[model samples]
Target: MNYMISIIIPVFNRKEYTRECLLSLGKQTDQRFKVVIVDDGSTDGTEDMLRQEFPEVEVLKGSGSLFWTAGVNMGIRHALKQGAQLIMTMNNDVVTDEHLIEKMYYWHEQKPEALLGALELDANTQQPIFGGERLNWLLNTIEEVLPTLPKDEQKGLHAVTHLPGRGLLIPRVVIEKIGLFDQDRFPHYIADYDYTHTARRAGFELYVNYDARLLTYPEESGERQIRSDKNFKNYYKHLFDLKGGGNLRDFTRFTLKNCPAPYIPFHLANGYTRRLFGYFLK
Candidate 1:
């Protein structure tokens, strides 16, 4: 079968953001790509804009409350059915380089067995964002506490652990072999982590292509801290339970041996003790 690239953007009441994302796609140097826009029950003007302005874009309407995972799944299925060789699930609030699609597709063709292809995501300042790291719980916690360093310090060429879905490209074979994102464990946060780890277990590589770049709103400001809400915490708890490899016993064993204590208190002291315990124990 001939190959086509599919770019899927999940929209949730972000009409302007969706428009910008689509515009970026339309501006791609590679025009042989199909766009699948999954409107996850957006009441905003997203639907109308797609119908009127973007007739070439495929629009998938949600039944009702479709979160990130479900929305991405919807698009993935559609893209696969449309004979997509490469699938990219990105956020609505992102702008891609004109050459982004072609670069990503080249890497996918080169590394046909890769689990995921990641681009170096930049903030408005065009700084490189870290895609993935083999982080223990303690290191991850410390990373959260440290102030944002210069982008150059964070830049490197390496095989990363997780590929952020914000601008990820997945080979069709990986999707067929390993399957889609785990919506049950992750409706939103950390779905990419679960997907990448699953692929790693299956012996597929995870990579970052610095040449393929895009600008994303990386939750840099106060928005970095999601609002304090029980629903959000519930989402995270579900994420851990669904994503964790083992129980508290396993987590303790994994952490004490691999994780450092200094970073734990440094980054996550403000987190609730119960949350910390659950994360550490689980």
Candidate 2:
């Protein structure tokens, strides 16, 4: 049978998380999708384990330099070559709901032109983590959509300007239009944000489907902190760290690509100010 959807995942050394994620996919009610797991230089025997346990999955090899954007791009290229009608991009750390694909398909059927972003919940708290978001360029901030509302009340489709890359479903047509991610500018973080904004600019609508959800672990605490032991070194390292937005350089690139002319300076200043204050307080 021809696969209707191709699920693309970019993974590193997290074998346990990848295993659980694949297990969840195995339980998905809709079996019409194919999975493409891009192993980006995993030293933890991820490839061996996948071959033994999940032989049916197509495993694409990647050098560590590919990061998130390039790794997913490789998988997307393969999926497109295979003639996939739809593509789903996701992280290896998420355990998806069994009906996620089914619901996403239903939503896509309703609005075939829109990019569908799944609602993500915290694995420990089961509370909404990220669903839909709006970018406040003036304030240089991103606001969560209906964050305070109860989960049940957050049901239905919401049009959003910003969507997380954690779980995004895109039609093949949209990919053909927007093209692949910019790995040089955004190696890891914010690449998803950039892509969504590009799609919106290209006249593709973005939607968040509350019914399609996944459970993801919270980001590591203290990952963004500047250590006091080696103050200068740590501060410098933090400035270029991928998790905390990768310093002023990455922010500058993001602003130039996404922000309006008048707002670029404000965005850059706001980002630098936040990082400076955050480092001092740490």
Candidate 3:
């Protein structure tokens, strides 16, 4: 049977997280989807585990250099070759709702040209983490918008300017027009934002399907009360690490490529100043 949806996931050494993510996908209410997992040179026995346990999943191999963007691109190409009607990119760290695929398919049926994003919720607390985001072009910053609708609010699609790739669904037609993620400029981070921006520029609408939700764990740092580390050098090194998507160089590249010409310098200056301070300021 032809697959209606192809779920593409890029993973590294997170064996446990990958297992849980695959388990969640296996439990999805709609089983009309095929899973394409790209293991980016994971030496942690991730490949062996998937082969033994999730044998039906198509595992794509990647060199250590692919990172996130290239890994996802590999999976996308495989999915396209398999004749997937819709391609969904998801992080291996997330546990999706059982109805997530069903809801995504339903929403796509309603708006075929729209890119669908899932409502991400905190896995531990089960609270809504983020719905969608709006870009502040003036400050060259993206702000997360948490929908404050009532508990009984009707479940429907909401328009969004920026959608994270954590659980993004795109119809095959959108990819044909907007193309895949920019692996060169944004090999790790900012590729999601760039792709969504490109989709919007191509006249494709973006929407968050409230009914399709996924659970994600919060990042160790950022707003979650950072721990004081005496080793400032190591701290700074990790903070500016290109793999984690916090480096000033990558940020400057992303800003200059996507942001307005006049605001590029300000965006770079502001980001650099923030990195210099080493502490997030309110």
Q: Evaluated with TM-score, which candidate comes out highest?
A: 2
Rank order (by lDDT, best first): 2, 3, 1
Summing lDDT over every window of 10 consecutive residues in candidate 2, give the lowest-scoring window. Answer: 220-229
- Number of clashing pairs per prediction, in order: 1, 0, 0
Clashing pairs in 2: none
Mind giving the per-residue lDDT tens digits that candidate 2 earns over 128-243? Answer: 87778888888777877867557577876888896778789988888888798888899888888888999999999998999899998866322434443437766776678765
Across residues 35-63, which tens digit of lDDT does each residue of candidate 3 receive?
89999899999989999999999999998
Better-scoring candidate (lDDT), 2 or 3:
2
Score every model by TM-score.
0.73, 0.91, 0.90
lDDT of model 2 at position 248 = 65
In terms of TM-score, how similar is model 1 to the real structure? 0.73
Candidates in order have lDDT scores of 0.67, 0.84, 0.82
Worst 10 residues of 1 by lDDT: 221-230
lDDT of 1 by residue, 183-230 (tens): 765666557767886787677888776557787776532223322233
In candidate 1, stretches whose alpha carbon ends up further than 4 angstroms from where it belongs are 121-123, 136-157, 220-282
